[model samples]
Target: MLEVKNLYKEFNNRPILKDISFTLKDGEIMTIVGPSGAGKTTLLRIIAGLETKDSGEILIDSQAYDSGKVGVVFQDYNLFPNLNVLQNITLAPTMVLKESKEEANKKAYELLNRLQMNGREKQYPYELSGGQKQRVAIARALAMKPRILCYDEPTSALDPNLRKEVEKMILGLKKSGLTQLIITHDLQFAENVADQMLKVQPLSEG
Candidate 1:
């Protein structure tokens, strides 16, 4: 289980997220939805340890949160233009975990196959379609074997058909017992995949 209590954040002393709290159970999908500037992305960043929270606590399965346990897929997919799909997926594992390159490559290939990206391992990001790029991003995250995966605006760049495909993929991951946290403005997409929905509002300056 992932539990967040009284999470708070601000930029330049202007509040972004205030008193945010929620709990997401194991193997379930939680979607956070709100209008732009509601700090939805910030909240995900905080959880992923890309940004700091001013107060409160984040715990995973009764232990304190560690960024290593969280992996985030940014809205843009964030694939390296210079790296081929295989390199992109294997980079973190080899560098961070200090795993042998061969070991990382083996796991990367498995992840690619699972994500339906097998033959494209040698292709660069520029050669991939939007949906394919998203798959690569997901593969990259999954290669890390994170306990929790967070997505920011996952369907923002896709058409309705692609959105449905992503919904199916997320649901498939649930069956494999991976906890997911998604931040998106598309309520319909959120409704389709989320086991729980969280609505957030922007804080008022006044």
Candidate 2:
């Protein structure tokens, strides 16, 4: 389970997220929706340890938030431009987790196959389509063995058809019992995938 309490954030003395609180149970998908600049991504970043929160408490599975236990898939799919898909997925596991090359490669190959990205191991980020890149990004995150998976604007770069494919992929993850947190402006996608949807309203600077 994930618990966020009294979350607050600001930039340059201006409030962004104010007193945001929520709880996400295991095997559930929660989507945070709001307009751009509403700090939806910031909330995810804070949870992912990419950014710090001004004030809040985040607990994952009864423990404090840890980068190793959380995985984030950014909107741009942030794969290394120079690395092939397999290398990109295995980089973190080998570096951070200190897994051996053989072990990391085995896990990466299995994840790629599960994500239906088996044949693209040797392909560079530039060669893959948008959806394929997203899948690779997801596979990289999964390689981390994170207890919680978060996505920022997952479908913003895809066309309608590709969006549906990604949607199915997310649903498949949910069925496989992964806890997920998604930040998106795509209402229909949220409605289709979210077990619960929360709107992030911009804080008023009265």
Candidate 3:
């Protein structure tokens, strides 16, 4: 289970998140909805250990939040512009996890196939469409095999048709029993994929 209690965050003395609390059970999908500046991404960053909370606690399965235990698919996809799809996905597994090149390539092949990105392995990020790039990003995250996956603004850059496709992909992940946290402004996408919904109200200044 993932549990966050009384989380607080501030940047340059300006509070972005305050008193945030939530829990996500294993294999559950949670969608966080809020306005653009309401810190939805910040919350996900905190959970993924990319950013630190000023106060409170985050626990994953009763242990402290560890970077190795969570994976994040950033809003911009964040794939390496110079790396081909296969290289992009395999980089972290080999560099961070120290998996052998052969093992990493095998895992990347499986993930690419599962994400329906088989033929695009040799293509760089620029050669792919927005949806394809996002899929590569997701594949990269899954390559880490983290216990929890978090997506920020996953559908923001996609058209309606692509949004639906991504939505289906998320549902597929759920069926695979992966615990997920999605931060999206798309209500329909949220409704389709979220097992639970969280609304992060804008923090009021005193």
Candidate 4:
């Protein structure tokens, strides 16, 4: 299970997240929903270790994740322009995980297959469409094999046709039993995939 306690964050004396707390179980898809600027993204960043919390504890399966064990899928693909699809996924594992090039390539190939990116390995980011790049982004995160997956308004930036494709991919991950925490304003995405939903409202706003 993942547990968060007394989370707090501030910037320039303005509170972004205030005393937020929650727990999430493994294999569960928990979504955080609310209006814009409600601290949803801030909370996810803190949980992902992309941002520092003023005070609180984030734990995953009894291990502290102050450095963050979760993987985040940003709205933008966050891909490197110079790398091909396959290289983007393979580089991190062999480089950061210190696995052999052979071993990393094998895992990368498997993940590419699982991510339905067959025959597209040589494609550059500029060559692929937005939805496709986002799909690659998702695959790259999965290749890392994180303990928790966090998505922030994943499909919000895509057009409807493009959005459905990304939506289907996320749904596919859930069907295969990936543990996820999503923050989105899109209610349909939550209704279609979330195992549990929590609406975050500030202490005085509600």
Candidate 5:
């Protein structure tokens, strides 16, 4: 559903992404694997439209969705701290999608249910466990209903065992037929859930 070509980005004359290009097919889960400073997150941001590429093209469903078109699950779980789970999840639907309050709330509730946060709708981000908070972040993104979902190492903070819970939620999204690109250092998670892997190739010496 998405394609990118010849993507290049630079910081202070140093390249962050060099000739990065790929496609995310419909209903397929693709994982971007690389070490730190490999431009994984920058690639996600550029594709999401949050950041601009110095040179490249991105197509979403035959049109351009920018990096902003990709729904993000960042490691920090950027929730509005004061907004409860349901409110946080419904914000985009109401503001961006222009749905009515009742409509947004209905969709929010259903999403929370699917994410297993049904009765916790009234809870604030600070009130939840780390996993619960990440779940809310997932629900918030899914409620946006983006055709492409991008995750930036969503399990970075959890204990290894707790990491599995968040991984399960992400894996489940893949099973539900969502098109996704996950940037991760955790190869185990990638091997378990990704349909294909995009490992960052080495930069050649001058």
Candidate 6:
């Protein structure tokens, strides 16, 4: 379970988020939806440890959250342009986790197979479609074995068909008992897959 308690954050003495709290149980999908400047991404970033919160407590499984326990897939699908899909997915496991190259590659292949991205291993990011890139990004994140998986604006540039693919993919992950957090402007998409919904409003400027 993930619990965020009374989170507060500010920049330049201006508040971005204030007194925000939520709980996401394990094997659940929680989607955060809001308009622009609503701090949706900021909250996600804080959870992923990409940004600092002025004050808050983030706990997973009733203990303090570790950034390593979270894996984030950015809006732009931040796959390395120069690396092939297989290399990208296996990079972290080999380097960060110090797993053997063969072991990392084996795990990457398994993830790719699950994502239906088999045979695209040698393809680079530029050679793939938006949806394909997103799948690779997801596979890369999953390879890290995070306790909670997060997506930022996952359907931003996807066509309707591709969006549906994402919806199905998320549902499949849930079946495997993965905890997920998603930040998206697409309310309908959020409704389609989220086990719970959180609506965030922008903090009024002082």
**Candidate lDDT values, in order:** 0.93, 0.92, 0.91, 0.81, 0.84, 0.94
**Predicted candidate 1 versus true structure: per-residue lDDT over 2-105, tens digit per residue:** 99999989899999999899999999999999999999999999999989999989998889888899988889999999999999999999999898999999
Task: Show pairs that collide, candidate 4.
Answer: none
lDDT tens digits, residue span 47-83, model 2: 9998899998999887877777888899999999999
Runs with alpha carbons beyond 4 Å of true place in candidate 6:
none
lDDT of 5 at 94: 92
- Model 5 C-alpha lDDT per residue in residues 1-206, reported as the tens digit of each score: 88888888887777888888888899998999988878888888888777888998888988855544678888888999979898999988899889999998998888888888889999889999878888888889988888988888876867789777866877777778889888889998888778888887545433
Ranking by lDDT: 6, 1, 2, 3, 5, 4
**Per-residue lDDT of candidate 3, residues 59-120 (tens digit):** 98999778788989998998999899999999999998999999999999999898998988
Q: Give each model's clash number.
A: 0, 0, 0, 0, 5, 0
Name the lDDT value of residue 84 in candidate 1. Answer: 95
Candidate 4: tens digits of C-alpha lDDT, residues 28-83: 88989988888898898888888888988888888867343677788786898899
Q: Could you tell me which residue pairs clash in candidate 6?
A: none
lDDT tens digits, residue span 1-206, model 6: 89999999998999999998999999999999999899999999999999998998899889977999999999998899989999999999999999999999999999999999999999999999999999999999999999999999999878877888899999999999999999999999999999899999988888
Model 1 quality (TM-score) = 0.97
Candidate 1 vs candidate 4: the TM-score winner is 1
Which sequence of candidate numbers ranks them by TM-score, best first? Answer: 6, 2, 1, 3, 5, 4
Winner by lDDT between candidate 6 and candidate 1: 6
Scanning candidate 2 in windows of ten residues, the lowest lDDT window is: 60-69
Model 2 residue runs over 4 Å out of place are none
C-alpha-based local distance difference test score of model 4: 0.81
Model 5 stretches astray by more than 4 angstroms: 201-206
| Candidate 3 Cα outliers beyond 4 Å, as residue runs | none
